[model samples]
Target: MCNQARFLAGAIFSLGLVVSGCSSVPYDGTSGMTDSNVRTSIYSTLDSTALVYTNPAAGAPADDNPWRWAGFVMHPIGVGLDYVVNRPLYSISSTFPRATGYTNEDAMLDAYRQR
Candidate 1:
């Protein structure tokens, strides 16, 4: 077929270029990848999820961090309207104890609620 001949010609040309030391990429490009590396990296990361979880700084922190808190605070505030809004279960139980004279959270909330 015509397409087959063109494919063979391209393959032979590539081989010839490599043999003659004519093939190359610029310094800015990847040393191994002929196209993009991101698609490959995405697939590779999905394939190796354990590699991400074991690392603390793997994009998202599993533990409490102020950065994490700030990001979710807005979304939770929005969604929370559903759960606590005008519901019989919604007692005005203070989410945080009143500002304790001490800076401790437990003591503050406890003191706030007059518990």
Candidate 2:
């Protein structure tokens, strides 16, 4: 009975870690996230700037057997989870802004002008 209790607790903890690990939303340090227009504009601009430059398919020329097998197992799981879980979360998150003021453009243009 004690072993069973320990196993149950461990299982619950593992599940919590997995869920919490993936569950995060973008946040910039500002308050008053009540304005819909500001949220929409900020979300749009941030989306444009946050480009995925790294090619997902690009990796080391050779991986060992374990890595190859791990990737084989995890890649499809990631895609499936992304479609079922991440896509909807992303859509919902886009409705909120990452920053309350000063977008990426503002910072970049200002730096350019200074230089």
> Model 2, range 1-115, lDDT digits (tens) per residue?
9999999999999999877863585656456565442322213234454335544244323342468878888999999999999898877765653544547787689899998
lDDT of each: 0.57, 0.65
Q: Once superposed on the true structure, which residue ranges of model 1 sit more than 4 Å away at CA?
A: 22-115
TM-score of each: 0.20, 0.30
Output the lDDT of residue 114, model 1: 100
Worst 10 residues of 1 by lDDT: 37-46
Q: After superposing candidate 2, which stretches have Cα over 4 Å from the reference?
A: 1-63, 98-115
Question: 1-115, model 1: which lDDT tens digit per residue?
Answer: 9999999999999999767663463455355665333222222333466665565345342343687767777887867776778442344434433432344776678789995
